[model samples]
Target: MEETWNEVLRDLSVPEDIATKWWSQIMVQYTESARIYHTMDNYLRKKFEIYDIMVKDNISERSAFVLAMFFQHYEHDTNVYGDSIDKNVEHVKNFFKDAGINHEGLISTVVGLLGAACESGSSKEGIDAYFQDLELAALGASPDEYVEYITDIEKEYSNMPAHFYRSLRLKVLQTLLLIPKIYSTDLFYEKYETQARENIEKEINEVLK
Candidate 1:
């Protein structure tokens, strides 16, 4: 990992200090001390919390902050583990910001998902509409099945061996690459898919190599 990052750092050909900062940032994510389960569990908890938060009509600032946590939440809730959640959360936060994807509408649509869960929203039915709104690839076409796929995977993430976390992350990257189109909606496809793919490819290469 360090070697790859060093290669990237040198490729950028920046000043020593700038390269050092970038390397430090990359290494911070690479050296996260927590088992992936803790990070995954926090992500799940935040997702559930956001769902419950959306059930209410009035969303307070704190509530919105809670929602924001889905985008940037770190869980260091255990004394047993050293520092599991913060670095992982930091990596995600950086990813979202770097993705440059406008999430405003996507955020609003997700909050509406819990409500839509009943109508045609039973995971399968609802997710197609949801994904169309978010414009992720063909993932939403079969909503419930996709939901189950994700849920099952999250479950696996929580239980998988610590050494395999990188492998699991790679698997997910490969899955996305295999999708017919990364963004189902033409808007996202046109605007963000290329950069998104490049970012994923970089990470995928980092993990595999």
Candidate 2:
């Protein structure tokens, strides 16, 4: 049994399910590898605390994970982790699809996650000040104007991590563009309204974008 487990760990790139099991079984509490694994678990826990809030809903969780994988790998002009993008993205996408969600809403979901994550780390005073300006600006803009504003911001932040932040910004833009269409159009609104909080989603999407 120990030999079989060792062989599996040697192929560390085995499926996540297999990896999880092997780690759980072979890396017992007092072992050296187990200590390293638990340390990693703690790090992931801390990093994903904001992620948990962002993905409070199961659908959002799945989608955010998928989008993260996609951007982390396929985002253009990324300054970090460029060459390995394709392989990483493929690995992430496979993880998501393998985990069960197979679709496009993940982008929207991830934008919300990033927003929540960002907001969690900000001071109340800072967030209040930022939102005051944001609210005033939002009230005055049309959908196209909003998109233009986001694009401008996107351009200003040229050094953004394309996968994580930049891609998230784009999705937020897409959601903002999509909201008016979602609400004003009876057909589109009716279709998605039952499942998603259209107005809230729109507002949150806009704020993040």
lDDT of each: 0.42, 0.38
Give the TM-scores of the predictions, in the order they appear: 0.31, 0.25
Instruction: Give the Å shift of residue 55 in candidate 1.
Output: 20
Tens-place lDDT digits, model 1, residues 1-209: 23433443344343556546545654443234543432334233434443343322332232323323332223333332224334434444454344343456544443443233223322322333323323233133244444444444445355456457667668877987886666544444555467556666666776677
Write one digit per residue (lDDT tens) for candidate 2, span 1-209: 23433343344334666546534532342133312212223223332342343222323244344234223312222344344344445544554455454445653444333333213223323322222222223223455544554454445355665556656655654554564332222332344343334333454555566
Top candidate by TM-score: 1
* Model 1, TM vs. native: 0.31
Worst 10 residues of 2 by lDDT: 127-136
lDDT of 1 at 71: 28
Candidate number achieving the greatest lDDT relative to the actual structure: 1
What C-alpha lDDT, on a 0 to 100 scale, does residue 113 get in candidate 1?
39
